[model samples]
Target: MRPPSRSSLILFAAVLLAGCASTSSTQTTPGSVPMTQDSTPLVGTDWRLVSAPGTRAGATLSGAGAATLRFEADRFSMRGPCNRHTGAWSRSGDQLRFGGEGGAVAGTKMLCPPEIMARETALLAAMQQPLTMEFEGPFLRLVAGDGSAWRFDSRDLPPAEGRERIVQVAGQRVPCTGAAPMLCLQIRTQPGAAWQAHYGEIEGFDWQVGVEYVIRVREYTVQDPPADGSSLRWVLEEVLERSP
Candidate 1:
């Protein structure tokens, strides 16, 4: 081991660095590296927009009905504060990809209040990128590539049993456009009372156009309704009266 030349010293330093790198790699902690796995059951889960780690603050979360994100089989839908958006979705390990390849999200263009539109714009942008999903109980968090996130809360379980009620249904369908273009049946609690357009559907009930009916029905809030559907469903219990 005579005095080492400059060339030898440089070579020795390089070998030392290479050995240290090998050792460091072998000694790395499992938690220090990201782990990927199949995410929780996202299908049929409807997440209501709420405050999250790095999402917009205050009014955005509190305004309107906020927004909702629901996942399906290879697809996802979002109801923004203003518009309705939908896109193709697929998950790999812990990541969620929106659209298809490089496609953009599609949505309705209905204009809304300025504050609502602002929130909708941000929500739509967030959904168009790569996201890492995490869940904690009833909450879901979607972290974007830039570290920002959108958090949604949910309790999609079905509700308790319903109560039976007696009601009258008109013989004809009236046009109702509350949520979208559709026809609604006129219903009332009393025969002499005013008729209110029933925006929600009545299950298990069939009506002939010229026949009026009085029926006993079971009404309850749906436990796991569709993302854009009404939570209430009325099922016909008994036919008390039917007159043509």
Candidate 2:
């Protein structure tokens, strides 16, 4: 058998750990959550994430904040949510069992703002209940009975218009540097290749980087940007580049 993906492990751990701290004051209403009709076990079908009410602590959500869940006979894979997570699963009556503590999930270590992290923490804590799943049209509704819900479907993104070369910025690259810990890289947008950006916590502060590459130095400044005020300034202590 093949090994499980890292994201899957993390998702499993996060979900499990989220359940560890159960003293949060939030009380769940006592009632039976409606389950989807027993057409077939959703464990072998592909489902896409439509909406995630709660967020995570240290990560960036991709696109409109949606993800995909591909459920195998004994395992599953979740794509989107800015990361891919998968692992084994089991079902007992109405209770679903995602791979317990043994599974692993690889995720971005980058931290999010404190407030956002709190929300994510709450969501994780909310995942402790006997979750419920129902079919909402083409989407699957995943509810943890703690007021948190997620939607999924099966749809692939459209392909790019044409083939293009990936250009490297010669002098436009900014080395992210400062006391704050972040894998920051500032690169000026080039022709054809518009800057794609994603930035969350900076100097332990909340900063938004739209398109990941298109640098908006002004926005960083209003929120108390680097004291030096260098638009082209960035620091990436850890960076992984894929070869073409």
Best of the candidates, TM-score = 1
Candidate 2 residues lying further than 4 Å off, grouped into runs, are 1-41, 54-65, 101-128, 157-244
Q: What TM-score would every model get versus the actual structure?
A: 0.44, 0.41
**Residue-wise C-alpha lDDT for candidate 2, range 1-244, written one tens digit per residue:** 1121211112232322211212222322222232456444465556655456644443323232335666665455655443344554444445554444424323333232233334344433444444566665556676786657765564444553322222222222234545553454333234334433323332322224332221112122244556644443232211111111
List per-prediction Cα lDDT, in the order shown: 0.60, 0.39
- Which 10 consecutive residues of model 2 have the lowest summed lDDT? 235-244
Q: In model 1, which range of ten residues has the least summed lDDT?
A: 14-23
Backbone steric clashes in candidate 2, count: 28
Q: Whole-model lDDT, candidate 1? A: 0.60
Candidate 1 Cα outliers beyond 4 Å, as residue runs: 1-40, 52-65, 101-104, 156-244
